[model samples]
Target: MKYCAANYQFSFHSVNMRRMNDLRGIDLNLLVVLEALLAERHISRAALRLHLSQPAVSHALGRLRQLLDDPLLVRGQGGLVPSARAHELAGPLAEALAQVRILLGPSGFQPATARRSFRLAMSDYGAMALLPGLLRAVRKIAPGIDLVVSQASREAMTAKVADGEIDLALGVFGQPPEGVHSTELFEETYACMVDAATVRGLGKLDQVAYLARSHVLVATHSERVDAIDAAVAKVGGRRKIACVLPHWSVAPALIAGTNLVLTTARRSLAAFEEDPRFAVFDPPFPLPGFGFSLIWHDRTDADPGHSWLRERVIAVAAGDEPDDAISLRS
Candidate 1:
């Protein structure tokens, strides 16, 4: 039976009144006993269904009688007859139980059948490396879905995820504040990128050659220039820092036609592939490898659409070609 809002309000008010003027207080467990009592009719059978002793069922029935101001069940030739009052409550109570079931039930999410906007935050390098493949893969699966990508500062990232302001985050940082989950997307090796023409004119880069040439560094929030100094100290070297850039994305354009060698993620080098002037080569000395990851709120952990999006991101991170049947990134 369909339950209207008016009927639900009336039923709730009726139950509330009985509780206000009850014998001391009403036991909510009495509703379970009342349900079983109305279903089975016999006290022993109601007790069996409720997993209560017969005496306990009888005691609950007594309290229910006083609370409802009705016998609730009457012994008749039919075994037990529900009082008119009990029959009156049956429909509304059943509807209430069913509403709760629907609230907690499993949800169906079909990407092709859904139109949802996913908001994501990541650094420009992260976007350059993963978004092209990620977007292509998702389009094959969910043509109608939309994506909103934006740059986010570390100070605001965790709060944005917690408030559902952003769906996911991808970057080199890890260990988000409590209530966020993170997974390693991939490990990134750094390479020195410079103009191929310039490198040929300058000859092979040695410690002295590297020190003599101007260098561009992505400053961000790290003391990376000092770290480079310490790492190359054993080899008796120093680098002449010519510029400090705020983001890795800006380095490509700054060194596009110059002799300045800038270090950046190899995966991100794809952004500069179209420029023939630029070339990526291994650093002559050892450098740190950056590991990027995807982060999201725990609340979205079991959501089907969010899970699907997260999996696609991981696939893109693993260097998968989106058109193939089996994504290599997986």
Candidate 2:
């Protein structure tokens, strides 16, 4: 059934007299419970969503039924079915509560004391570059805050951010999806990693020497063609792509003992800068660099916790300790 503001207000008026008499008893928390109850349609399921005991949820439902003078949900064979009044309130109630969340904001995020979990999406390369220091900072200060990181394609990550499935994402982006905002964290350029032993103690590759060896490609699925490939085209030769994989983390292992060339972000090979077995060098050809960024939906922009997390991420990207948060932009 299609719900409208007019219909929702009309239903609210039916109980307005009773609510007006007992206005003091109408709790926002109770309404929150009602929203979950209406959404779950099962006492136990609602309790799980709210992190409350089943009896507690039942008590809240009892109070809600008394306040609204309607048995919002009734027993059904499957679970609980919403009554006419509940159907009327469901859509509008959810809409109103969403607005209320935006209105109140996150209040404030006290990372030292907060017991919250955040979900972030990024590629394996992003994880390699950002996770080490970010994790250390989280452990030192925000012990109560937990992070869950997952990897997916840029399109999947952006879609998840838009749908509220993922809180934040970090990567190089082309054009972000609608309602998503992105800020550049840092700039990265293409670099070639090769087995130093086979490359004859060379710190860099010449144009002819670069195309002679087999290459390990990190196909991000964002694009098949990149700046180096364009550069190689200008020189009238193609890279011998012996292996094409989707992850940057595994490239080092593949290029360690073989005469394989892996061209990827400089940060991807930064950890191996000191390793004598590997040589991370600039390509002989000129390749345009890309800006790595952090992206999240506008829905999370004002959230204090999310903003705090974004600060920490940006701080890490800038090679700063996350002890004090920095806001690059308002």
Candidate 3:
């Protein structure tokens, strides 16, 4: 009687083992192809969406059939009709995929506690104007996280964010590239800068006095000069652009002892605004109030660390100044 009971248990265990093996041998990629097929109901369209050729999609479907032991998709007068088994599997498979995505997606980032290294690309002016406040906030909050800041050319900035060469970018920018997100940090008009020593010695500047002085233009490619030219055109004037620099950080040092005047963001010039050696003025005509933004790749949108970094940068760059201090710094 003991031997009879043992033989019965062994038979049940063997059957269970075979079922587990059948499930284990099913390829996950094939499941994904099946999900796509179930959605589109057209092989060619699903192939294009998955970036696979039509033949590859068909091969995956063949493997899916052998594993599932069913003609999962059947062609009918109305197009492909999912078999009853396919309909049953679809709901559970989709639910399982959703759960998997939630489990494997990026972790939640906490700025005050997280340890991470954030990469950023920006001009020197952007770095000087924005980074100090951001660094202060980081040191106070996420001190464990390090920041890697790099210089980027105008042409390469958008592509760098898109390709993940950098995690985020800060600058005066136009439209963001596809697959990127941008949040406006601040907007301030341009201010004309001059050496206080030169202005003091040469006397105060009127519109003519401004145009007569030499200019130090920050040209990000040649179009910058043209933009400046058009801004000055209303005054029946053109600047004598004696010096050109790629960034605002160097512009301050260059203008310190020279007669050359530069035009830049008020935020960029904030540090120098109170200094005795520099003078700031409004341009002859409005030189377009451009927006400074914090931009990042869409792929990083769900990443906790990336989100934290972007949030802090925006907060600081926006100047989160208290409403009690409503007086504009005129």
Best by lDDT: 2
Clashing pairs in model 3?
none
Task: Quote model 1's TM-score.
Answer: 0.60
Q: Per-candidate RMSD vs. true structure?
A: 20.1, 7.9, 16.0
For candidate 1, write residues 209-282 as lDDT tens digits. 66778888776555655456666676777777889866767788888667887766776676666666776777
lDDT by residue (1-330, candidate 2, tens digit) is 357877988888878866667748668798888877765679997787677899999999998898788999999998989899987776567546555765764456667776656668899989998998888887777888878787888887887676555679998777997789999999998888888897775676898888887788788785767677888898898988898888888888998778888888998888888898888888888788899999998777867777788888888999999664533222
In TM-score terms, which candidate is top? 2
TM-score against truth, every candidate: 0.60, 0.70, 0.62
By lDDT rank, best first, the candidates go 2, 3, 1
**Worst ten in a row by lDDT for model 1:** 321-330
Candidate 3: worst-modelled 10 consecutive residues by lDDT: 321-330
Displacement of residue 100 (Cα, Å) in model 3 is 11
Ranking by TM-score: 2, 3, 1
Q: Which of 2 and 3 is the better model by TM-score? A: 2
| Candidate 1, superposed: residue stretches over 4 Å from native | 1-106, 201-204, 222-230, 233-238, 271-276, 321-330
